[model samples]
Target chain A: MEILNALINITDKGAGFLHSIPALLIAIPLGAAFLAPILFKLWKRLAEIITGLAVTACLVLAIYLVLFLGNTPIVYTFSGGNWEFIQNLLPLGIVFVVDKLAAFMLLVVSILVFFAYLFGLKYLERFTGLGKYYTLYLLMFTGMIGLVMTGDLFNMFVFMEIAAISSYALVAFGTEPEELEAGFKYMVMGEIASIMILLSIAFIYSSTSTLNLAHLSYAFTQMQTQMASTPGFRAGFYFVLILLMFSFSLKAALVPFHSWLPDAHPSAPAPISALLSGVFIKVLGVYAMVRILYNVYGFSWESSPEVFTALIVLGLASIIAGSLLALNQKDYKRLLAYSSISQVGYIILGFGIGNLFALIGALAHILAHALGKGLLFLTSGSVVYRTGERDLGKLGGGLGKYMPWTSLTYNLGALSVAGIPPFLGFFSKMFIILGAIDLARVWDSDPSKPGWTMIAVAIIAGLFAVVTLGYLLKITNQVFWGKSEEKRTLKESPFIMVFAMVSLVVLLLAGGVAFFFWLKPELLGPAADVLLKGTKYGELVLPGLFGAGG
Target chain B: MLILGISLVLILIGLYAIITKRNMIKVAVGFALMEYAVNFLFAIIGFHKVPGMKIIPPILMEVKTTANVLSSYSDPVPQALVLTSIVIGLGVTAFMLSLALRIYNRIGSFDLDEIKRLKG
Candidate 1:
């Protein structure tokens, strides 16, 4: 009851403005990125120090927003007041809207990025062109935060391109022949996806003369009500929706569209591998799709059966294929990359289930995978940093005995990812299956009637859950605790590297335990409700719909 | 409708080249083709034409007399959007071209099939 009152009180103060908080989140990192080279020229180590300070500041701001905004969304127009003044003048202008979900993603992105930067501090010592690397890193960082915050469609596209372009450069940052090949492939696929999305945006802008997300959703809802029976309108509308979904799914790397992930992820440096696997796909792919499809276009399993069914099929295929393919990998990072694909399957599955618990489960899985896979990748980087080798066959032999910190953290990550208890991944995977069962029971008409489809989905997911455990265990045994191989001068990683790994482990443990006690109900619940509320999103973001379509 | 048809045809040609071509440079060219097609589509979307309506460029020469500029001219927002999109596309094309050159320098082949070093 107290929490509800606090939430209402926050929402009551809806048009809260606090001195340009939203713009600074994007501008700080971007300014830092642009200035990094100049700083590098001035002093050798000042660029790194400034980047560290800037990212930490962003993280602080994100955490502050999560607490201060509470549950109500705050929309910031550049003019520092309510959007009503511009509502009558220009139909749409640059707006930054931060709601529960956006806040949650900001938190996740900031946390991961801060740690990734810390990890990169020591990790990039041997690499050349350190200034360019930091520049691209901060640029990608700015792009991720901006895409989530902006309330304009074309703005979102621009940020998406910024992130994509930087990531392509980062993937090939290693500059090996294989790394260049992977980067080129990733760029081509990403370009095609961006073009499709832009084309769809053009279609939307043609139908409605506004590019603002709030106005667009309002217009869409109005149009659907007015022309619900017009076949031509419906056909064009669904066509646009289909194009948008296809492009986003390609970015998300769902099933048939998943060729680039396995290649791009392994080719990058470890911290980047962590970022690409952790938040990049979730932000640029799944997050954008969910916001546009569910909130703007108003997709529901009942309303959009074809779309939901396609999602389910794609999710299932990714799970089975990603895991099975992971079984045959010889390289360590490649296997982890394949595992990432399968875990993304779990997130897609949760989204397709289309209920509260499922949404929460999916959101939780995003955080879990970011932490677990991030820890695993950083550990891989530490191993490579210690000894320049990556093959499981050549690099075995009781590695745990020498590096206790890496071994213990790696084991914890493996257990969590495999969905073991007292760890975060277990709860998320369990909630998704439970959500599936609830959906199945609700959809079935009679009490005694059987729900075969949802039941089969749950069962298949559960079975593959075991397969996930098997492969993780196999890899863990091979990498950390196996027969001795070639001996050399190798010790635990440097202090800074171990410090980053330890911090991740602590987060993983706290997140898992906090799942039962607090975070599920308070944080994830509100975020999921934003999705569940659907087109009511318009009301929350934009106060009125009268002048939306002009 | 004719403009839309032309855009689709342009996209298909680029798709065919991207799918069937073996040379890296050809793939890059195909990408450029697709970029222009999408840009052209955005330009078409922003355009408005009535059969008898006068066509005028969107300029503010007579701001007081023609305050309601929207009714007098075709929309220029999509034109502005396309301009920005085209510049970004050029950046992507240049980057892709450079990457292809680097790959050629390292692997000594423009054929994608021969550049099969990192496979399962």
Candidate 2:
């Protein structure tokens, strides 16, 4: 009975000091990042300790926020303790809104960052310039957290650049010829994308006369309803929206704009690769795009069917193209990177379907991929660390016999990613397929069109899931089932690496089995609700104006 | 409208260099050009040149009262935005230049075609 009361209290909306934790979430990391180099000069141990402590603290706060924002959003204004007055001038001050979606993302990113830091502690020992690596890594961490939490559009752009620039530097940290080339390519593409986004933001600011997300949403809605909307105004708004889509698609690595990802992901350090492949694209590219479209611009299938159709087409293309490309990769990390692109297609398709189940599926896929793909990358890194090999042809066959723990974890990861039953990926893929069918039914509201295209696309996506399994199983078979190549004995990875992989594997299994029972109600359901609410999100974040008027 | 068109043309020129240039330093210069174009556009967006009002700087010391300063001075917001964007552009340019230098050191050339060791 006492435990039940505590559980209820945990779910209740927090007040006072807890409300301020969102700011500290970004601040702690940013502060520690600046201090890391100075402390490194003092003692190498101190810098590592600070980074670990900062990430762990942020993770605890993230988990706390997830529970605290179960039903309520904390709208924090960065004013001089006079938010009451500034609340009326909503667009003037910088605001950080911690809703269920933001909290969910916070949980996803912090968990990955914390584990990656833990894994990198020993993994990075051989590399020089450890100080710079930790600094840039923390900066990247702070930028992503800020991106998800900021309520200002321009602030999002700023944080996005922070994340992008830091990542470009980290990708080149290896300083290899290939790494530098990949980093330069990524930097150029990323800069162009950011510039396009900035142009859109400028256009938006001109039209709406505000840079705050909530205010812009309110103003855009009002402008849509007003008869003063000219053809030129509509043209400009549509142009800005299209630019935003293109830019974000570039960042998200959705097929036509995904040329940079295959090179950049494989070129970075393995832990950074995991961070990039697992969460970076999702947060910087997918999450920001969704927020802008669904919440800021108020996208609905009934209202903007063309936009939804565009999303579906791009997603289908990515699903097919990314999978086919992954089949031809010789390098282990590049194959995984291409697979990341393919998995992201499922997310985009689910979101484009725009049903409750599909949105839930998309969010679930994000968590599943974060764990499964991150584990795969870490295991691959461990293999390389043990025996400096990245080629598939040279390092295969009976190696699994020597390192049974790594083999088991890799197989589990492969199984989960391939959507095997009772694993996390299976449930996410099931919901997405179901959601696609539901979308087809709704889209066929006009009797003339049968909506077979969407159904076919769903079928094709499932077939591609088979392709995913084919490739993953091929790796497993090639690596584990053949004759042993190395003459010396191989041992399991150290405890730190094993602990990281084991935690991810455990979560992946538990999420799959307990998805409907606990995960949905506690996490995924609320997150999808936030997306489904659409422009009603504006009211939730800023209650002074447009209160409860959907 | 003319200013916007000029800014668009400048952007196109920069993009042409970015897409067609093979030298890494040329690409970096192209990026700088694009950055400046955007900054110019931002300046035009915030420019307030009312014909009848007396022009003044945004600083309060230049004006006697609040009303005159409000009507005559520039909006200042876009200027601030341009300043911040310029700084960000500088950082990106510096980082890109450093990366280009490292690539040159690695391959002993600045041409991008020679740096194709990472192809599929």
Candidate 3:
């Protein structure tokens, strides 16, 4: 009764502002997406303008939300909006908890979506159904934003499905055989991953009797205490953890489970590909992994050594395997897709190292990779648009001669992803490798232990770095620098596309230099703190839901 | 228990069909079978055994205010989730069927091996 009173009091104090922000974030684009087709019927230009404005407004709103709740978490609850039946049945219908981490993710997603939509204005002209494309794109945007903000497990799954299904359709938008095949393969793998997630949720719900993440975390803590000595329960927990890790890793396309990405990413149109590689994988896979590990399962290296080892092993495998795969790819988009796998490996490795510096590196890498890879894919799209060629071997000639702006941005993007200094990627890689070394030093006192494994992984990461540099340079030389034997007909892409590419390049460089001043404390610090104090997350989220005193 | 066992068997059969079937349509049907098996499992998970489960009362009568009312209300959450999942499955299946039809139209075959535009 007292707890309920406290909750009511809290709501009364801040419910008006807090409750509306998340809904506004989700509803604006979703409503725009829905109205886009109708608006297109009346005036086609209005559809793009409305969507671009909606996304930009969302970006600004997210930035404001982040600044407003700097280093502080905001919890908002909506009890079915005065619907009597729902209110009576499910008193606590749904809640959205938007902390700094969610706000940061929302910012990243909205910015990317805004740019992608702007680019789509010109790029989507060739496609038959422009209105339908924007509609699906807006739906995808809503799902990602909602996924980041929602604090319920089932709601997250629903949002994830929304995003995944829309992406599958977008990938197959071309209706060509390759696109269809890629979409089919992507759907199959995605369905399997979703099933795994559903099964895991079913197990968790049956065990905890709740779907609210905060409540579930509370239940998990109580279960842990009561069954601390029970080996069977511990084993079951580990099994569920592995299930989640596997499912999320599949979504992230970490090496062994990465067969679908190279196909699916290359098959999608440029803007869609940008979304897929830039933010889709991060939201679906990396964000969920971080949330579950930090807030739900309460895992860290010091507490759960086995889980940490699993993460490290998987990250290393992806790094090495993705690099090797990229070395052999001749298709331009497929090569970029492989590089995405490798970059994701770097992010996962940073998280797996389980330190503050590593977490910062991981977050920074997500931001940088999104910009760099997004630019690369968009540039490739422009290249394909102008030349109608995807094979690297068939098309080679001074692209820089024809499209100077695109070549410049593409070079900057490649250099960034390859971790060249003065680009965004280098700072992130440096921090992550330094964190690994620090962790190794911490574990070195015990000579019989495998502390040297970190050093070995670090070396492998370095070697992969060189491999990435080699391929990126090879691509640059082949496509942009060398002259073709045959006469190649190429022209610069439309102004809008070039503008989008250039802006992203500028943002990437600026973000790289101003990492400390801009992103660190606002985004990275709080996220790292959440991960570092993993189990305390339960206490923070479910303050009155557990223990004897309650 | 019997329902659970049957659903497990159905899933195994679906898996077998998926692995052994050469026709794309058959493979798609196998996927449907698997989805049905999963849905059945979910429904079974929500089901509770009880006596006097049905009540045919007047339209506007006193509601049953018994302990059984609370105890016998099956897990409606999973049921709702399953309904949504079934609809999603239907959408995906329809899309796949159309895709298969398109492939057949283009390639003039139902054999999966012959419709191989994408390869390593």
Scored by lDDT, the top model is 2
User: Which docking class does model 3 fall in?
Assistant: acceptable
lDDT of 2 by residue, A1-550 (tens): 4743453353333556567777788778998998898899999888899999899999999988887664768877665554466474464666888898899999999999988898898788888888888899999999999999999998898899899999999999899999999999999999999988887877787677678888888887888855255888788888999999999999999998999999999888889999999999999999999999999988898788889888888788888899999998778888899999999999999888889989999899999988889989988888887877888888866878777878899999988987888999998888899898887787699676568887997898889999998887767777766787567677877889888888889889999989989888889999999899888888877777775344
Q: Candidate 1's residue-wise lDDT over A467-542, tens digit each?
A: 8888777667887887576675668988888999899989989999999777797678889999998887777777
Residue A170 lDDT in model 1? 99
TM-score of chain B of 2: 0.85
By TM-score, the best candidate is 2
- By TM-score, highest first, what's the ranking? 2, 1, 3
What lDDT score goes with residue A118 in model 2? Answer: 83
lDDT of 3 by residue, B69-110 (tens): 645456677777788778877876787687677767766776
Considering DockQ, which of the candidate structures 1 and 3 is the better prediction for this target? 1
Which structure among the candidates has the greatest DockQ?
1
Model 3: how far is A241 from its true place, Å? 2.4
Model 3 chain B: lowest-lDDT 10 consecutive positions: B54-63
Model 2, B1-120: lDDT tens digits are 898898889888988999999999999999999989988887667656768656545554456677767555666777777788888899999999999999988789999999998877
Candidate order by decreasing lDDT = 2, 1, 3
Poorly placed runs, candidate 3 (over 4 Å)? A1-19, A81-91, A226-232, A446-448, A487-489, A546-550, B1-9, B15-22, B50-72
